[model samples]
Target: MNVIETAIAGLLILEPTAYGDDRGFFLESWNRRRFADFGLDLEFVQDNHSRSAAGVLRGLHFQDPNPQGKLVRVVNGRAWDVAVDIRAGSATFGKWVGVELSATNKRMFWVPDGFAHGFLALEDDTDFLYKCTSYFEPANEHSLQWNDPILGIDWPLDGLEPQLSGRDRVGMPFAAIATVA
Candidate 1:
């Protein structure tokens, strides 16, 4: 596995070495020692999966009290994934990083706990999967507006309007999120 660092601290893009034969391919999705060697010492407690249509956009979401560090990937089809730094006094607060995750490329994105996460499906049906460092507690979850002008996320909508959930449509404005400068 090749782990690449992003401009934002704790965010990593990992590329696995896939061995393909006449039938299909095989790759190591997770390895405790290997990941630890690279200084990623996450203990995932839950795994989540979702399927979304092309225009569907989920999140810019995070759990405040119990923030979840996520290792995300696209099992089928494609998605444009994003992670935004929301740590109260971090150097990159309010900044973000985006990456295209696809089944073909088999890339994995690591979003650490201090950030909000979201994704846009680039294909008709996309299977999104992730390993979470913490168990989800709905009451602790919060959403940051996906289209917040302050963050200025350049979502590659490709002429289509993003289809958002009621919760996401009414997310907190970036400026309104209480954080110490």
Candidate 2:
């Protein structure tokens, strides 16, 4: 696997080597020992899978008291994934990084605890998966407005409008989250 570091600390892009034959391809998505070799000795407590239609957006979400470190990727179709640095007192606070994750690229994104994570489905029926280091606590979860002007995330929306959930539509602004984060 090739680990690519992002501008913000602790955020990474992992590309695993795939071996293929006439039938198909195989690649190890996660192996405890192998990940440890790269200084990622993490313990995941939960796994999640979500499917989104084109233009669907989820998150800019994170837990405060129980921040989760996530290893996320797209298993089918494509998505424009983003991670924002919301960790208080960090050098990159309010900064963000975005990447295109797709089944074809077979790349994984690592979003450490203390950051806000979100993605926009770029294709129909996008299957997004993630392994979380901490179990989710609904009450502790908060969503930073996906289109918050302060964060200024450049989502690849083109001519499409993002479909958001009620929670997301009413998310707190980045400035407001500063106090809580």
Best by lDDT: 2
Cand. 1 TM to true fold = 0.97
For residues 1-181, write the lDDT of model 2, one tens digit per residue. Answer: 9999998879999999999999999999999999999999999999999999999999899998989999999999999999999988899999999999999999999999989999999999999999999999999999989999999999999977899999999999999977754
Best candidate (score: TM-score): 2
**Where in model 1 is the C-alpha error above 4 Å?**
178-181
Superposing all C-alpha atoms, what RMSD in Å does each candidate have to the true structure? 1.0, 0.8
lDDT of 1 at 84: 94
- Displacement of residue 53 (Cα, Å) in model 2 is 0.3
TM-scores, in order shown?
A: 0.97, 0.98
User: Per-residue CA lDDT of candidate 1, range 1-181, in tens?
Assistant: 8989999979999999999999999999999889999999779999999999998999999997989999999999999999999998889999999999999999999998899999999997899999999999999999989999999999999888999999999999998874443
In order, the Cα lDDT scores of the candidates are 0.94, 0.95
Please give the lDDT score for candidate 1.
0.94
